[model samples]
Target: MHAKLGLFFLFLSLAAIAPLHAAEPAPPTANATDAASGAPTDAATEAATEAQSSANAGAQIPDTLEQRLLACAACHGKQGEGIAKSEYYPRLAGKPAGYLYNQLRNFQEQRREVPIMTYMVAYMSDDYLREIAAHYARLQPPYPAPAGGYPEQELARGEALVRKGDADKNIPACSACHGKSLTGMEPTIPGLIGLNREYIVAQLGAWKTGHRHGAQPDCMSQIASRLSPRDVAAVSAYLTTQRATADSMPALARSARLPIDCGVVPGASSADPELGIAVPEASGESFGKDGKDSKEPGS
Candidate 1:
Protein backbone atom coordinates (compact mmCIF):
# COMPACT_ATOMS: atom_id res chain seq x y z
CA MET A 1 0.00 0.00 0.00
CA HIS A 2 2.85 2.45 0.87
CA ALA A 3 4.64 1.74 -2.45
CA LYS A 4 1.41 2.36 -4.41
CA LEU A 5 0.80 5.69 -2.62
CA GLY A 6 4.40 6.84 -3.23
CA LEU A 7 4.02 5.93 -6.92
CA PHE A 8 0.85 8.04 -7.21
CA PHE A 9 2.56 11.10 -5.64
CA LEU A 10 5.53 10.61 -8.03
CA PHE A 11 3.13 10.61 -11.01
CA LEU A 12 1.54 13.94 -9.86
CA SER A 13 5.01 15.58 -9.43
CA LEU A 14 6.07 14.50 -12.97
CA ALA A 15 2.83 15.89 -14.46
CA ALA A 16 3.40 19.34 -12.91
CA ILE A 17 7.06 19.41 -14.02
CA ALA A 18 6.08 18.35 -17.55
CA PRO A 19 3.95 21.47 -18.11
CA LEU A 20 6.76 23.73 -16.75
CA HIS A 21 9.29 22.22 -19.20
CA ALA A 22 6.85 22.50 -22.10
CA ALA A 23 6.05 26.16 -21.37
CA GLU A 24 9.74 27.18 -21.84
CA PRO A 25 11.12 25.63 -25.04
CA ALA A 26 14.83 25.82 -25.77
CA PRO A 27 16.12 29.25 -26.95
CA PRO A 28 16.31 29.64 -30.74
CA THR A 29 19.74 28.52 -31.91
CA ALA A 30 19.26 30.32 -35.22
CA ASN A 31 16.43 31.77 -37.33
CA ALA A 32 13.49 29.33 -37.68
CA THR A 33 13.84 26.82 -40.53
CA ASP A 34 11.56 24.67 -42.67
CA ALA A 35 11.48 21.16 -41.28
CA ALA A 36 11.12 19.45 -44.65
CA SER A 37 14.21 21.02 -46.30
CA GLY A 38 16.00 22.81 -43.44
CA ALA A 39 15.79 26.15 -45.34
CA PRO A 40 15.68 29.45 -43.40
CA THR A 41 12.13 30.89 -42.99
CA ASP A 42 10.57 34.21 -41.75
CA ALA A 43 11.57 36.26 -44.86
CA ALA A 44 8.19 38.07 -44.94
CA THR A 45 8.23 38.81 -41.20
CA GLU A 46 11.80 40.11 -41.40
CA ALA A 47 10.94 42.40 -44.29
CA ALA A 48 7.87 43.74 -42.43
CA THR A 49 9.94 44.49 -39.34
CA GLU A 50 12.56 46.43 -41.36
CA ALA A 51 9.87 48.46 -43.10
CA GLN A 52 8.28 49.32 -39.73
CA SER A 53 11.64 50.44 -38.37
CA SER A 54 12.24 52.73 -41.35
CA ALA A 55 8.81 54.27 -40.95
CA ASN A 56 9.44 54.98 -37.26
CA ALA A 57 12.77 56.62 -38.02
CA GLY A 58 11.20 59.00 -40.53
CA ALA A 59 8.42 59.98 -38.09
CA GLN A 60 10.94 61.27 -35.53
CA ILE A 61 11.77 64.45 -37.50
CA PRO A 62 9.87 67.79 -37.57
CA ASP A 63 8.55 69.94 -40.45
CA THR A 64 10.55 72.76 -42.14
CA LEU A 65 9.85 76.54 -42.02
CA GLU A 66 8.60 76.43 -45.61
CA GLN A 67 6.19 73.67 -44.66
CA ARG A 68 4.92 75.73 -41.73
CA LEU A 69 3.92 78.85 -43.73
CA LEU A 70 1.52 77.27 -46.21
CA ALA A 71 -1.07 79.97 -45.53
CA CYS A 72 1.28 82.78 -46.61
CA ALA A 73 2.09 80.86 -49.77
CA ALA A 74 -1.59 80.69 -50.59
CA CYS A 75 -1.65 84.48 -51.05
CA HIS A 76 2.00 84.98 -51.81
CA GLY A 77 3.76 82.55 -54.16
CA LYS A 78 5.38 79.24 -53.30
CA GLN A 79 8.75 81.00 -52.86
CA GLY A 80 7.29 84.24 -51.49
CA GLU A 81 7.49 85.64 -55.01
CA GLY A 82 4.58 87.81 -56.19
CA ILE A 83 1.39 86.35 -57.66
CA ALA A 84 -1.89 87.82 -58.90
CA LYS A 85 -5.33 86.88 -60.15
CA SER A 86 -8.04 89.56 -60.28
CA GLU A 87 -6.51 90.93 -57.07
CA TYR A 88 -2.77 91.25 -56.66
CA TYR A 89 -1.07 89.82 -53.57
CA PRO A 90 2.41 91.25 -53.26
CA ARG A 91 5.60 89.21 -53.18
CA LEU A 92 6.86 88.88 -49.60
CA ALA A 93 10.39 87.62 -50.19
CA GLY A 94 13.44 89.91 -49.77
CA LYS A 95 11.60 92.75 -48.04
CA PRO A 96 13.08 94.22 -44.85
CA ALA A 97 12.02 92.11 -41.86
CA GLY A 98 10.89 95.21 -40.06
CA TYR A 99 8.83 96.23 -43.06
CA LEU A 100 7.23 92.81 -43.23
CA TYR A 101 6.76 92.62 -39.46
CA ASN A 102 5.17 96.04 -39.34
CA GLN A 103 2.76 95.26 -42.17
CA LEU A 104 1.60 92.08 -40.46
CA ARG A 105 1.18 93.97 -37.21
CA ASN A 106 -0.79 96.73 -38.88
CA PHE A 107 -3.22 94.12 -40.14
CA GLN A 108 -3.46 92.69 -36.63
CA GLU A 109 -3.92 96.07 -34.89
CA GLN A 110 -6.76 97.45 -37.03
CA ARG A 111 -4.50 100.39 -37.75
CA ARG A 112 -3.82 99.17 -41.30
CA GLU A 113 -7.19 97.78 -42.37
CA VAL A 114 -7.71 94.49 -44.29
CA PRO A 115 -10.31 91.97 -43.09
CA ILE A 116 -8.70 88.73 -44.26
CA MET A 117 -5.24 89.68 -43.00
CA THR A 118 -6.74 90.84 -39.73
CA TYR A 119 -8.43 87.48 -39.17
CA MET A 120 -5.31 85.59 -40.22
CA VAL A 121 -3.09 87.35 -37.68
CA ALA A 122 -5.60 87.91 -34.87
CA TYR A 123 -4.09 85.23 -32.62
CA MET A 124 -0.41 85.88 -33.35
CA SER A 125 2.05 87.45 -30.93
CA ASP A 126 4.67 90.07 -31.81
CA ASP A 127 7.42 87.46 -31.74
CA TYR A 128 5.49 85.25 -34.11
CA LEU A 129 5.08 88.19 -36.48
CA ARG A 130 8.79 88.87 -36.31
CA GLU A 131 9.60 85.27 -37.09
CA ILE A 132 7.41 85.31 -40.15
CA ALA A 133 8.94 88.57 -41.33
CA ALA A 134 12.43 87.26 -40.84
CA HIS A 135 11.62 84.08 -42.72
CA TYR A 136 10.43 85.92 -45.82
CA ALA A 137 13.03 88.63 -45.58
CA ARG A 138 15.77 86.05 -45.82
CA LEU A 139 14.29 84.43 -48.88
CA GLN A 140 15.64 86.25 -51.98
CA PRO A 141 13.67 84.48 -54.66
CA PRO A 142 13.70 85.57 -58.32
CA TYR A 143 11.13 88.11 -59.43
CA PRO A 144 8.54 87.43 -62.11
CA ALA A 145 8.85 89.16 -65.49
CA PRO A 146 7.23 92.58 -65.78
CA ALA A 147 3.84 92.21 -67.49
CA GLY A 148 3.96 95.55 -69.35
CA GLY A 149 1.50 96.17 -72.15
CA TYR A 150 0.53 99.75 -71.31
CA PRO A 151 1.10 102.93 -73.35
CA GLU A 152 4.67 104.35 -73.49
CA GLN A 153 3.57 107.82 -72.35
CA GLU A 154 1.87 106.37 -69.29
CA LEU A 155 4.96 104.39 -68.32
CA ALA A 156 7.18 107.43 -68.88
CA ARG A 157 4.95 109.56 -66.67
CA GLY A 158 5.11 106.89 -63.99
CA GLU A 159 8.90 106.82 -64.17
CA ALA A 160 9.12 110.58 -63.70
CA LEU A 161 7.04 110.47 -60.54
CA VAL A 162 8.99 107.58 -59.02
CA ARG A 163 12.34 109.18 -59.82
CA LYS A 164 11.31 112.81 -59.15
CA GLY A 165 8.29 113.41 -56.97
CA ASP A 166 5.90 116.31 -57.61
CA ALA A 167 7.77 118.88 -55.55
CA ASP A 168 5.07 121.47 -56.26
CA LYS A 169 2.56 119.18 -54.53
CA ASN A 170 4.94 118.54 -51.58
CA ILE A 171 5.19 114.85 -52.50
CA PRO A 172 8.71 113.47 -52.09
CA ALA A 173 10.17 111.04 -54.60
CA CYS A 174 9.37 107.32 -54.13
CA SER A 175 13.15 106.82 -54.07
CA ALA A 176 13.37 109.17 -51.08
CA CYS A 177 12.42 106.29 -48.77
CA HIS A 178 12.76 103.37 -51.20
CA GLY A 179 16.43 104.07 -52.00
CA LYS A 180 17.90 105.13 -55.37
CA SER A 181 17.49 101.56 -56.56
CA LEU A 182 13.92 101.58 -55.21
CA THR A 183 14.93 98.38 -53.37
CA GLY A 184 13.86 99.77 -49.92
CA MET A 185 15.80 101.04 -46.89
CA GLU A 186 16.93 99.15 -43.86
CA PRO A 187 15.18 98.71 -40.45
CA THR A 188 11.64 99.15 -41.87
CA ILE A 189 10.88 100.80 -45.23
CA PRO A 190 9.89 98.56 -48.17
CA GLY A 191 11.00 98.49 -51.81
CA LEU A 192 8.51 99.62 -54.43
CA ILE A 193 9.76 97.47 -57.31
CA GLY A 194 8.54 93.91 -58.00
CA LEU A 195 4.90 94.73 -57.18
CA ASN A 196 1.84 94.47 -59.46
CA ARG A 197 0.29 97.59 -60.94
CA GLU A 198 -3.14 97.05 -59.40
CA TYR A 199 -1.74 96.20 -55.96
CA ILE A 200 0.35 99.32 -56.04
CA VAL A 201 -2.64 101.44 -56.99
CA ALA A 202 -4.89 99.81 -54.39
CA GLN A 203 -2.39 100.24 -51.56
CA LEU A 204 -1.86 103.87 -52.45
CA GLY A 205 -5.62 104.29 -52.56
CA ALA A 206 -5.86 102.74 -49.10
CA TRP A 207 -3.34 105.19 -47.70
CA LYS A 208 -5.09 108.09 -49.36
CA THR A 209 -8.57 107.10 -48.14
CA GLY A 210 -7.28 106.34 -44.63
CA HIS A 211 -8.44 102.74 -45.16
CA ARG A 212 -4.80 101.73 -44.64
CA HIS A 213 -2.62 103.44 -42.04
CA GLY A 214 0.84 103.24 -40.49
CA ALA A 215 2.50 104.69 -37.40
CA GLN A 216 1.27 108.12 -36.33
CA PRO A 217 2.27 110.84 -38.77
CA ASP A 218 2.35 108.13 -41.44
CA CYS A 219 4.43 109.43 -44.38
CA MET A 220 2.66 107.18 -46.87
CA SER A 221 -0.75 108.48 -45.83
CA GLN A 222 0.40 112.05 -46.38
CA ILE A 223 2.14 111.18 -49.63
CA ALA A 224 -0.67 109.04 -51.03
CA SER A 225 -3.26 111.61 -50.02
CA ARG A 226 -1.35 114.17 -52.03
CA LEU A 227 -1.24 111.97 -55.16
CA SER A 228 -3.93 112.39 -57.83
CA PRO A 229 -5.42 109.28 -59.42
CA ARG A 230 -3.23 109.88 -62.45
CA ASP A 231 -0.12 110.13 -60.30
CA VAL A 232 -0.98 106.85 -58.60
CA ALA A 233 -1.58 105.10 -61.93
CA ALA A 234 1.62 106.45 -63.47
CA VAL A 235 3.77 105.54 -60.47
CA SER A 236 2.30 102.06 -60.26
CA ALA A 237 2.90 101.43 -63.94
CA TYR A 238 6.55 102.51 -63.87
CA LEU A 239 7.38 100.63 -60.68
CA THR A 240 6.16 97.26 -61.94
CA THR A 241 8.37 97.57 -65.02
CA GLN A 242 11.60 97.75 -62.98
CA ARG A 243 13.37 94.55 -61.89
CA ALA A 244 14.84 93.79 -58.48
CA THR A 245 18.61 94.08 -57.96
CA ALA A 246 20.64 90.88 -57.80
CA ASP A 247 21.60 91.60 -54.19
CA SER A 248 17.98 91.94 -53.03
CA MET A 249 19.34 93.20 -49.70
CA PRO A 250 17.65 95.87 -47.63
CA ALA A 251 19.91 98.89 -46.97
CA LEU A 252 21.44 99.25 -43.53
CA ALA A 253 21.01 103.04 -43.60
CA ARG A 254 19.15 105.69 -45.58
CA SER A 255 21.20 107.64 -48.10
CA ALA A 256 19.13 110.76 -47.40
CA ARG A 257 16.70 112.07 -44.76
CA LEU A 258 13.00 111.31 -45.30
CA PRO A 259 12.66 114.92 -46.81
CA ILE A 260 9.55 115.58 -44.70
CA ASP A 261 8.32 114.95 -41.17
CA CYS A 262 6.10 111.94 -41.88
CA GLY A 263 7.36 109.91 -38.87
CA VAL A 264 9.80 107.61 -40.72
CA VAL A 265 12.73 109.35 -39.08
CA PRO A 266 15.55 107.56 -37.34
CA GLY A 267 14.48 105.59 -34.23
CA ALA A 268 10.80 106.19 -35.08
CA SER A 269 9.83 102.70 -36.14
CA SER A 270 11.26 100.83 -33.16
CA ALA A 271 10.59 97.20 -32.33
CA ASP A 272 8.16 98.38 -29.68
CA PRO A 273 4.50 97.86 -30.50
CA GLU A 274 3.91 101.48 -29.43
CA LEU A 275 5.22 102.57 -32.84
CA GLY A 276 1.97 101.14 -34.27
CA ILE A 277 3.96 100.41 -37.43
CA ALA A 278 2.76 96.84 -37.31
CA VAL A 279 0.11 95.40 -39.55
CA PRO A 280 -2.91 96.44 -41.59
CA GLU A 281 -5.76 94.60 -39.95
CA ALA A 282 -8.56 93.37 -42.20
CA SER A 283 -11.44 95.88 -42.45
CA GLY A 284 -14.25 93.46 -43.43
CA GLU A 285 -13.79 94.48 -47.05
CA SER A 286 -13.74 92.11 -50.03
CA PHE A 287 -10.52 91.84 -52.09
CA GLY A 288 -11.89 89.82 -55.00
CA LYS A 289 -12.65 91.41 -58.38
CA ASP A 290 -16.30 90.35 -58.02
CA GLY A 291 -16.47 91.45 -54.37
CA LYS A 292 -15.60 88.12 -52.75
CA ASP A 293 -12.51 86.65 -51.10
CA SER A 294 -9.59 86.75 -53.51
CA LYS A 295 -8.36 83.48 -55.02
CA GLU A 296 -5.68 81.58 -53.14
CA PRO A 297 -1.93 81.70 -54.14
CA GLY A 298 -1.99 85.16 -55.75
CA SER A 299 -5.06 87.15 -55.01
Candidate 2:
Protein backbone atom coordinates (compact mmCIF):
# COMPACT_ATOMS: atom_id res chain seq x y z
CA MET A 1 0.00 0.00 0.00
CA HIS A 2 2.91 2.45 0.87
CA ALA A 3 4.63 1.77 -2.53
CA LYS A 4 1.32 2.27 -4.41
CA LEU A 5 0.61 5.56 -2.62
CA GLY A 6 4.11 6.89 -3.46
CA LEU A 7 3.60 6.00 -7.16
CA PHE A 8 0.25 7.79 -7.15
CA PHE A 9 1.92 11.05 -5.79
CA LEU A 10 4.64 10.83 -8.45
CA PHE A 11 2.02 10.44 -11.20
CA LEU A 12 0.20 13.52 -9.96
CA SER A 13 3.43 15.53 -10.02
CA LEU A 14 4.22 14.38 -13.59
CA ALA A 15 0.77 15.30 -14.81
CA ALA A 16 1.11 18.87 -13.45
CA ILE A 17 4.59 19.32 -15.02
CA ALA A 18 3.43 17.96 -18.38
CA PRO A 19 0.60 20.52 -18.62
CA LEU A 20 2.99 23.40 -17.74
CA HIS A 21 5.50 22.30 -20.39
CA ALA A 22 2.84 21.88 -23.08
CA ALA A 23 1.41 25.38 -22.44
CA GLU A 24 4.67 27.14 -23.55
CA PRO A 25 5.18 27.77 -27.35
CA ALA A 26 8.42 26.51 -28.93
CA PRO A 27 11.27 29.00 -29.57
CA PRO A 28 11.36 30.23 -33.16
CA THR A 29 14.09 28.81 -35.37
CA ALA A 30 16.88 31.20 -36.43
CA ASN A 31 18.09 31.52 -40.01
CA ALA A 32 21.50 30.01 -40.85
CA THR A 33 23.09 33.45 -41.34
CA ASP A 34 21.60 34.84 -38.13
CA ALA A 35 22.72 31.83 -36.17
CA ALA A 36 26.21 32.03 -37.64
CA SER A 37 26.46 35.77 -36.92
CA GLY A 38 24.96 35.41 -33.41
CA ALA A 39 22.61 38.32 -34.13
CA PRO A 40 18.83 38.70 -34.29
CA THR A 41 16.44 41.10 -36.01
CA ASP A 42 15.51 44.11 -33.85
CA ALA A 43 12.37 46.27 -33.49
CA ALA A 44 14.09 49.16 -35.26
CA THR A 45 14.88 47.03 -38.30
CA GLU A 46 11.27 45.88 -38.54
CA ALA A 47 10.04 49.45 -38.21
CA ALA A 48 12.37 50.62 -40.97
CA THR A 49 11.19 47.91 -43.28
CA GLU A 50 7.55 48.92 -42.70
CA ALA A 51 8.37 52.56 -43.28
CA GLN A 52 10.14 51.85 -46.56
CA SER A 53 7.24 49.82 -47.79
CA SER A 54 4.77 52.59 -46.94
CA ALA A 55 6.92 55.20 -48.69
CA ASN A 56 7.19 53.12 -51.84
CA ALA A 57 3.46 52.52 -52.01
CA GLY A 58 2.55 56.23 -51.58
CA ALA A 59 5.43 57.85 -53.45
CA GLN A 60 4.69 59.66 -56.71
CA ILE A 61 5.44 63.16 -57.96
CA PRO A 62 2.30 65.33 -57.98
CA ASP A 63 1.08 65.06 -61.58
CA THR A 64 -1.88 67.47 -61.72
CA LEU A 65 -1.82 71.22 -61.01
CA GLU A 66 -4.05 70.71 -57.95
CA GLN A 67 -1.71 68.05 -56.58
CA ARG A 68 1.31 70.26 -57.20
CA LEU A 69 -0.45 72.99 -55.20
CA LEU A 70 -0.14 70.84 -52.09
CA ALA A 71 3.53 71.76 -51.87
CA CYS A 72 2.54 75.43 -51.39
CA ALA A 73 -0.42 74.68 -49.11
CA ALA A 74 1.97 73.04 -46.67
CA CYS A 75 3.25 76.51 -45.76
CA HIS A 76 0.89 79.13 -47.19
CA GLY A 77 -2.39 77.50 -46.11
CA LYS A 78 -5.13 75.57 -47.87
CA GLN A 79 -6.61 77.20 -51.00
CA GLY A 80 -3.70 79.67 -51.06
CA GLU A 81 -5.27 81.47 -48.10
CA GLY A 82 -2.73 82.95 -45.72
CA ILE A 83 -1.77 81.38 -42.44
CA ALA A 84 -3.35 82.86 -39.31
CA LYS A 85 -3.04 86.53 -38.50
CA SER A 86 -0.63 85.91 -35.64
CA GLU A 87 1.72 84.06 -37.96
CA TYR A 88 1.89 87.04 -40.37
CA TYR A 89 2.35 84.91 -43.47
CA PRO A 90 1.10 86.79 -46.55
CA ARG A 91 -1.90 85.70 -48.62
CA LEU A 92 -0.79 84.27 -51.98
CA ALA A 93 -4.14 83.65 -53.64
CA GLY A 94 -5.15 86.19 -56.29
CA LYS A 95 -1.65 87.67 -56.44
CA PRO A 96 -0.04 87.91 -59.85
CA ALA A 97 1.96 84.74 -60.50
CA GLY A 98 4.73 86.78 -62.05
CA TYR A 99 5.21 88.70 -58.79
CA LEU A 100 5.06 85.52 -56.76
CA TYR A 101 7.64 83.78 -58.94
CA ASN A 102 9.99 86.76 -58.78
CA GLN A 103 9.65 86.90 -55.00
CA LEU A 104 10.42 83.18 -54.75
CA ARG A 105 13.49 83.62 -56.92
CA ASN A 106 14.48 86.59 -54.78
CA PHE A 107 14.28 84.48 -51.63
CA GLN A 108 16.38 81.73 -53.24
CA GLU A 109 19.05 84.15 -54.41
CA GLN A 110 19.32 85.83 -50.97
CA ARG A 111 17.95 89.06 -52.41
CA ARG A 112 15.22 88.92 -49.73
CA GLU A 113 15.95 88.90 -45.97
CA VAL A 114 13.62 86.19 -44.67
CA PRO A 115 15.77 83.41 -43.18
CA ILE A 116 12.93 80.88 -43.17
CA MET A 117 11.97 81.62 -46.77
CA THR A 118 15.61 81.64 -47.86
CA TYR A 119 16.16 78.20 -46.39
CA MET A 120 12.84 76.89 -47.67
CA VAL A 121 13.58 78.07 -51.21
CA ALA A 122 17.33 77.40 -51.21
CA TYR A 123 17.05 74.10 -53.03
CA MET A 124 14.07 75.04 -55.27
CA SER A 125 14.79 75.73 -58.92
CA ASP A 126 13.23 78.42 -61.12
CA ASP A 127 10.89 75.91 -62.71
CA TYR A 128 9.56 74.98 -59.29
CA LEU A 129 8.97 78.64 -58.39
CA ARG A 130 7.10 79.17 -61.62
CA GLU A 131 4.99 76.12 -60.92
CA ILE A 132 4.08 77.39 -57.46
CA ALA A 133 3.32 80.87 -58.79
CA ALA A 134 1.03 79.52 -61.46
CA HIS A 135 -0.87 77.51 -58.89
CA TYR A 136 -1.49 80.45 -56.53
CA ALA A 137 -2.33 82.87 -59.32
CA ARG A 138 -5.13 80.66 -60.53
CA LEU A 139 -6.77 80.56 -57.09
CA GLN A 140 -9.58 83.03 -56.32
CA PRO A 141 -9.03 85.94 -53.95
CA PRO A 142 -10.26 85.57 -50.39
CA TYR A 143 -13.47 87.42 -49.44
CA PRO A 144 -13.92 89.99 -46.64
CA ALA A 145 -10.56 91.59 -47.25
CA PRO A 146 -8.06 90.65 -44.61
CA ALA A 147 -8.25 94.18 -43.16
CA GLY A 148 -11.98 94.72 -43.27
CA GLY A 149 -13.16 97.94 -41.61
CA TYR A 150 -11.49 101.09 -40.36
CA PRO A 151 -12.44 104.18 -38.37
CA GLU A 152 -14.07 106.92 -40.44
CA GLN A 153 -11.16 109.26 -39.72
CA GLU A 154 -8.59 106.74 -40.90
CA LEU A 155 -10.50 106.11 -44.10
CA ALA A 156 -10.70 109.82 -44.83
CA ARG A 157 -6.97 110.24 -44.26
CA GLY A 158 -6.20 107.31 -46.52
CA GLU A 159 -8.52 108.59 -49.21
CA ALA A 160 -6.86 112.00 -49.15
CA LEU A 161 -3.38 110.61 -49.60
CA VAL A 162 -4.43 108.20 -52.35
CA ARG A 163 -6.33 110.89 -54.24
CA LYS A 164 -4.12 113.95 -53.77
CA GLY A 165 -0.37 114.24 -53.58
CA ASP A 166 1.24 115.74 -50.49
CA ALA A 167 2.71 118.50 -52.65
CA ASP A 168 4.65 120.19 -49.83
CA LYS A 169 6.71 117.05 -49.27
CA ASN A 170 6.57 116.03 -52.96
CA ILE A 171 5.03 112.68 -52.01
CA PRO A 172 3.30 111.42 -55.11
CA ALA A 173 -0.12 109.75 -54.78
CA CYS A 174 -0.41 106.04 -53.80
CA SER A 175 -1.96 105.53 -57.23
CA ALA A 176 1.50 105.89 -58.75
CA CYS A 177 2.98 102.36 -58.40
CA HIS A 178 -0.41 100.82 -57.66
CA GLY A 179 -2.69 101.62 -60.57
CA LYS A 180 -5.78 103.83 -60.20
CA SER A 181 -7.74 100.65 -59.42
CA LEU A 182 -5.02 99.49 -56.95
CA THR A 183 -4.45 96.38 -59.05
CA GLY A 184 -0.82 95.47 -59.67
CA MET A 185 1.09 95.77 -62.91
CA GLU A 186 2.23 92.58 -64.56
CA PRO A 187 5.81 91.24 -64.38
CA THR A 188 6.82 93.02 -61.14
CA ILE A 189 4.54 95.07 -58.89
CA PRO A 190 1.79 93.56 -56.67
CA GLY A 191 -1.83 94.69 -56.29
CA LEU A 192 -2.77 96.35 -53.01
CA ILE A 193 -6.47 95.45 -53.09
CA GLY A 194 -7.69 93.07 -50.36
CA LEU A 195 -4.31 92.92 -48.57
CA ASN A 196 -4.26 92.81 -44.79
CA ARG A 197 -3.65 96.16 -43.09
CA GLU A 198 -0.96 94.65 -40.92
CA TYR A 199 0.84 93.21 -43.93
CA ILE A 200 0.80 96.55 -45.71
CA VAL A 201 2.04 98.32 -42.60
CA ALA A 202 4.80 95.80 -42.03
CA GLN A 203 6.02 95.89 -45.62
CA LEU A 204 6.11 99.67 -45.69
CA GLY A 205 7.92 99.67 -42.37
CA ALA A 206 10.41 97.16 -43.73
CA TRP A 207 11.02 99.34 -46.74
CA LYS A 208 11.45 102.49 -44.65
CA THR A 209 13.77 100.86 -42.12
CA GLY A 210 15.80 98.95 -44.73
CA HIS A 211 15.10 95.61 -43.04
CA ARG A 212 13.72 94.41 -46.37
CA HIS A 213 15.56 94.98 -49.63
CA GLY A 214 14.62 93.84 -53.12
CA ALA A 215 16.45 93.39 -56.42
CA GLN A 216 19.04 96.12 -56.72
CA PRO A 217 18.00 99.69 -55.97
CA ASP A 218 14.86 98.29 -54.26
CA CYS A 219 11.95 100.13 -55.91
CA MET A 220 9.79 99.81 -52.81
CA SER A 221 12.43 101.49 -50.69
CA GLN A 222 12.32 104.54 -52.92
CA ILE A 223 8.55 104.80 -52.48
CA ALA A 224 8.53 103.81 -48.82
CA SER A 225 11.14 106.34 -47.78
CA ARG A 226 8.87 109.16 -48.84
CA LEU A 227 5.96 107.91 -46.70
CA SER A 228 5.44 109.13 -43.16
CA PRO A 229 4.15 106.62 -40.62
CA ARG A 230 0.80 108.36 -40.97
CA ASP A 231 0.94 108.04 -44.73
CA VAL A 232 1.66 104.34 -44.48
CA ALA A 233 -1.24 103.75 -42.10
CA ALA A 234 -3.64 105.81 -44.18
CA VAL A 235 -2.86 104.17 -47.51
CA SER A 236 -3.05 100.72 -45.94
CA ALA A 237 -6.45 101.52 -44.47
CA TYR A 238 -7.76 102.76 -47.79
CA LEU A 239 -6.46 99.77 -49.71
CA THR A 240 -8.09 97.34 -47.32
CA THR A 241 -11.47 99.04 -47.78
CA GLN A 242 -11.53 98.64 -51.57
CA ARG A 243 -13.40 95.84 -53.34
CA ALA A 244 -11.30 92.80 -54.23
CA THR A 245 -11.71 91.62 -57.81
CA ALA A 246 -10.43 88.90 -60.08
CA ASP A 247 -7.38 89.49 -62.22
CA SER A 248 -8.59 91.53 -65.17
CA MET A 249 -7.71 89.98 -68.52
CA PRO A 250 -7.56 93.42 -70.11
CA ALA A 251 -4.82 94.55 -67.69
CA LEU A 252 -2.31 92.40 -69.54
CA ALA A 253 -2.92 94.29 -72.75
CA ARG A 254 -2.53 97.66 -70.96
CA SER A 255 0.80 96.59 -69.46
CA ALA A 256 2.42 96.71 -72.89
CA ARG A 257 1.73 100.43 -73.09
CA LEU A 258 3.48 101.26 -69.78
CA PRO A 259 6.83 103.00 -70.06
CA ILE A 260 9.72 100.57 -69.86
CA ASP A 261 12.02 103.03 -68.04
CA CYS A 262 9.53 104.11 -65.34
CA GLY A 263 10.88 103.20 -61.92
CA VAL A 264 9.55 103.94 -58.43
CA VAL A 265 9.55 107.61 -57.56
CA PRO A 266 12.93 108.22 -55.95
CA GLY A 267 13.51 109.79 -52.52
CA ALA A 268 13.74 113.58 -52.44
CA SER A 269 16.99 113.89 -54.31
CA SER A 270 18.13 115.04 -57.77
CA ALA A 271 15.73 113.50 -60.29
CA ASP A 272 17.14 111.56 -63.22
CA PRO A 273 15.66 111.86 -66.71
CA GLU A 274 16.64 108.26 -67.51
CA LEU A 275 14.88 106.75 -64.45
CA GLY A 276 11.60 108.63 -64.72
CA ILE A 277 9.64 108.76 -61.45
CA ALA A 278 6.27 106.96 -61.68
CA VAL A 279 4.10 110.01 -60.96
CA PRO A 280 0.92 110.51 -63.01
CA GLU A 281 1.50 112.53 -66.15
CA ALA A 282 -1.81 114.39 -65.79
CA SER A 283 -4.37 115.20 -63.05
CA GLY A 284 -6.94 113.17 -65.00
CA GLU A 285 -5.02 109.98 -64.21
CA SER A 286 -4.88 110.63 -60.45
CA PHE A 287 -6.76 108.24 -58.14
CA GLY A 288 -9.55 110.54 -56.91
CA LYS A 289 -9.62 112.75 -59.95
CA ASP A 290 -13.12 113.14 -61.38
CA GLY A 291 -13.06 110.57 -64.18
CA LYS A 292 -14.60 107.05 -64.01
CA ASP A 293 -11.65 105.39 -65.76
CA SER A 294 -10.62 102.75 -63.22
CA LYS A 295 -8.05 101.01 -65.40
CA GLU A 296 -4.40 101.80 -64.72
CA PRO A 297 -1.00 100.07 -64.82
CA GLY A 298 -0.24 98.70 -61.31
CA SER A 299 -3.56 98.52 -59.49
Best TM-score among the predictions, by candidate number: 1
RMSD of 2: 25.1
- The stretch of ten residues in a row with the least summed lDDT in candidate 2 is 30-39
lDDT of 2 at 254: 30
lDDT of 2 by residue, 20-60 (tens): 21101111221111011112123223333433464478764
lDDT for model 2: 0.50
- Steric collisions counted per model: 21, 6
* Runs with alpha carbons beyond 4 Å of true place in candidate 1: 1-64, 267-299
lDDT for residue 234 in candidate 2, whole number 0-100: 79
- TM-scores for every predicted model: 0.66, 0.62
Residue-wise C-alpha lDDT for candidate 1, range 148-177, written one tens digit per residue: 887899888888888777879988777766
Q: Provide the lowest-lDDT 10-residue window in model 1.
A: 18-27
